[model samples]
Target: MVVAIGLEGSANKLGVGIVKDGEVLSNCRRTYITPPGEGFLPKETAQHHRKHILPLIKEALEVAKMEPQDIDLICYTKGPGMGAPLVSVAVVARTIAQLWNKPIVGVNHCIGHIEMGRAITKCDNPTVLYVSGGNTQVIAYACNRYRIFGETIDIAVGNCLDRFARLVNLSNDPSPGYNIEQAALKGKKLLPLPYSVKGMDVSFSGILSHIEEKGRPLLKSGEYTVEDLCFSLQETVFAMLVETTERAMAHTGSQEVLLVGGVACNVRLQEMMAQMVKERGGIVYATDERYCIDNGAMIAQAGALLYASTGQPTPWDETYIRQRYRTDEVEVTWR
Candidate 1:
């Protein structure tokens, strides 16, 4: 039955998930939210994870209708995430491994998303667009590895949106990005923001600065509304992402596109990508908020795959947290 539990606390969210034989039995999560104009700090985020991880773990186990004895393996994100939050979750994973006497494996955060997306959507040989607060890349599977075809040269697409939301003092109740998405729905006129796409790689910093300079003064003068600012910015950035992803698809000769990551939940981004993919006669696959956003089940799924293929758990000494883990660094032997 090969049951596994995954611990994920890469950024503001902390999640626990239980999976058995590639099926996610339970996924529980808690998020740390800052004020409208602020972003969650590493220290604050780590504290939030620490306070809720134990309870969240219990919830996941109960929800999955399983006990610790049934769990064959434990998984934790060995990351490309904030140092404090990554360490906080990794410590818990290690502790539980010892307490439960179960095998443990450190999973790459990005690969976790890819594996879950593939498992849920059942897409084959798809060009992946991984967009999140901390990362933005167009990737393709090749030679037993998920290769990065293109990536952000500066701030990520999510970072660009969050920063712009912060600049406009958008509500952060659910998330700054969600708030911006909502506000953008009422956007009337498209603003002229820089569309920076240098071949496969995209840049968002210049557009962010340009929006601050051009949008802020007009907003203060009542010349532009928040909706207008959000709408224009979203349009510009998503277009850049779609363009680069298309380039990767053409280069890889792929007929399928899979969107995975926090930003993958955005409907507008999905629509834009779908339009482009349709023109190319390709399929576009995406999951809703449940699987797209950061969570534990994805890690568990990926970890279980690794354990199944290699039959070796990560040694305690080698299970250290990696703050700058790259997507391309992982070897996908399970494929």
Candidate 2:
């Protein structure tokens, strides 16, 4: 069996995981939590990853009960994230590959999420809704690529929620999105917010701006609680997501809808997507936070698939990270 260890630090969370074939042996992650209303900066997030990466890697190895020499390849997320954080983990991957004398693969971060979702859920050739802090897209495999059928034209869905949390000074403990979900549970009213959907793409920046303006006076006057704003935002934004996903499903004639990425963990979004798919005699495949959010195991899984097909590692100079790497840029060799 081909064994690989993956390192992921493209965002705030630092993760390490081991995968053999399609099975995940271990997935470990440590998130960098900032104070209330504060967001993680790229430089600081990179520093956090650098500090905790070694321990996390050791922990993953122990959990997998495998030594470095047992691993055949190493993988790291090479793109679509903060430059500093991507480089932080890339440096570590290079070190490990050279020390262990194993081949290395640089996997696309978005493709990593999709591949991991498919592997864990066993949903083959499903339409993927990848919603996260940095990305929001409806993807489907076609013509040797994961083509984007729909996406956000402005800010991503997760970024909209996180920024709203900051406006309300919400705790960033578990996650801004998680906090919003909880607050939404207690919300009884749905305040009006802008909903912009052009063709297959969504726009969230306008809604965020509208909510900030409406929420400022209401919050100060005690006319509306943060809970109401959270509820309204979730309802409006998730509806747009569901609508766009439904359109993609209709266009692609897909019977399965798979949710991947950090924001995919939201129960409300899942419920909305499920309801929409159910009406069309389809099913929605979603995983828990472990597989949904950014992690190393997914990277390893995607890298392993590509490695199996190509039987080659990325050249030392070509392993550098790409900040704006698009999902279509990655050729789906395994599929």
Candidate 3:
């Protein structure tokens, strides 16, 4: 079996995971959380990863009961993430590869999530809805690539939630998005919010502006609670996502919908998707934070697949970070 160590620090989370072939032996990570009403910056995020990556790597190896020598391969997220944080993790993976004399491969962060989701849920050839702090896309496998069906025109869905959380002074400890999801649960009223979906693409900037500009009055005048605003936001945005995904499903004639990414952990979104899928007599698959959110195990899983297929390592010179790596760029040879 191929033993691999995966490194991921694409954004605020620094994760290290060890996997033997397709089995995950250890998954360890540290999230860089900012104070309430604050968002993490690239410099600080990279610093956080640098501070914790070594310890997490040690912890992961210890938990896996393995040594660097036992690791047959080292894998890391090559990107579609913050430049500083991506470079920081890449530096560590490169150093370890040289020190351990192990083969190394650079994996795309999005494919990492997709591959891990497929593995954990055992859902084959399902349409993917990827929602995260940095990205929002509806995708499907076609022509040896993860083809994007639709995507955000401006800010991502998670960014919309995170910024909204900041506006309302929500805690970013666990995550601003999680806090928003919690606040939305007690909502009793459906306040008005903009619904901007142009064909398959979505736009959240206008909705965010409307809430920030108009919804504040309702909150201040005691007409609407934070819960109400959050609930409305979630309902409106999730409806758009579901609509676009359904369109893609109809076009592709696929019966399964797989939700992957950090926001995939949201119960409301999953419930909404499940409801829609059930109506169409299809299934919806999702995973909790371990696999849903950014983690190194995914990188390891995807990397191991690539390595197993090619029997080769990514060259040291070509292991550069592509901060804006698109999901459709990587050719899916493993499939």
Candidate 4:
């Protein structure tokens, strides 16, 4: 068995996965909440990665019943994430690759999510909707690349949720999305909010501002509950996503939709997407927490495919973190 170890510390989460022959043996992650409450601080996140990544990697390796020396390859996320966090993971991965004398491959974070969704769902040629704190995009495979059919013009969908949660002093533990989802379940009112969609791209900045403005006045007057605001926010944002994704599928002539990213784990979002797709005689594939959120398994899955097909192992000298890498910039070598 050709074993591969993967590391992902691109955001606040530290993940490690072990895979052999395209099958995941173990995948583990340790999530870190921001200290200042909302939004990630690059320097702080890097420190967290430095402190927690080693233990998580060790735990994953032990769970897989393998050592660093037993691995044939080491894979790490290289771009489309915060620079400090990405650099932290890259430094560790390079050190391991050098120490173990193993080949290293740097994988795109977004592609890792898509590839992992494919692996988990066995969905071939599905139109991908990638929604996260840093990104919101509609992707489809065509020609030799995964094309971005549409994306957010301003802030990401998950970012909107986190920001809104922080605005109302929601729980700072775990993730704001979870807190928002929980609050939404208890909510009774549906507050009207803005919905912006242009051609294929979507925008949430206006909606976020509107929610804050409306909710603040109501809270000050004691006329509305926070739960209602949370519920309204999820409903509006998720509805926009459903509409745009459906439009993208129609344009691309795709019968399958794959939801991948940290926000994809939201049950409400999944239900909305699944219902919409089912109505159109299409299928929706949603991953659980393992692949939905950032994890090392997806990195290994994507890297192994790239390595096997391209026969190009990443050089330690060329390994660097890219904060603003675009999904369209990468050419997909694996189908």
- Per-prediction TM-score, please? 0.99, 0.99, 0.99, 0.97
Q: Write one digit per residue (lDDT tens) for candidate 2, span 1-335.
A: 78989999999988999999899999999999999989999999999999999999999999999988889999999999999999999999999899988999999999999999999999878999999999999999999999999899989999999999999999998999999999999998889888899999999999999999889999899888989999999999999999999999999999999999999999999999999999999999999999998999999999999999988899888989999999999899987
* Candidates 1 and 2 compared by lDDT, better number: 1
- What C-alpha lDDT do the candidate models reach, one value each? 0.94, 0.94, 0.94, 0.90
State the lDDT at 315 in candidate 2.
89
Enumerate residue pairs that collide in model 3.
Answer: none
Greater-TM-score candidate between 2 and 4: 2
Q: Backbone collision count in every prediction?
A: 0, 0, 0, 0
Off by more than 4 A, model 3: none
Candidate 4 on 1-335: residue-level lDDT in tens? 45778899888888999888779999999887863356778899889899988898889989999877789989999988988999999999998988888999999999999988998899989999999989999999988798998999999998999899889988757789988999999999888888798888899999998988888999888777999999999999899899989998998999999999999999999999999999999999998887899999999988898888888898667787788888888888766
Off by over 4 Å in 1: none
List, residue by residue over 104-137, the lDDT tens digit for candidate 1: 9999999999999999999988999999999999
lDDT of 4: 0.90
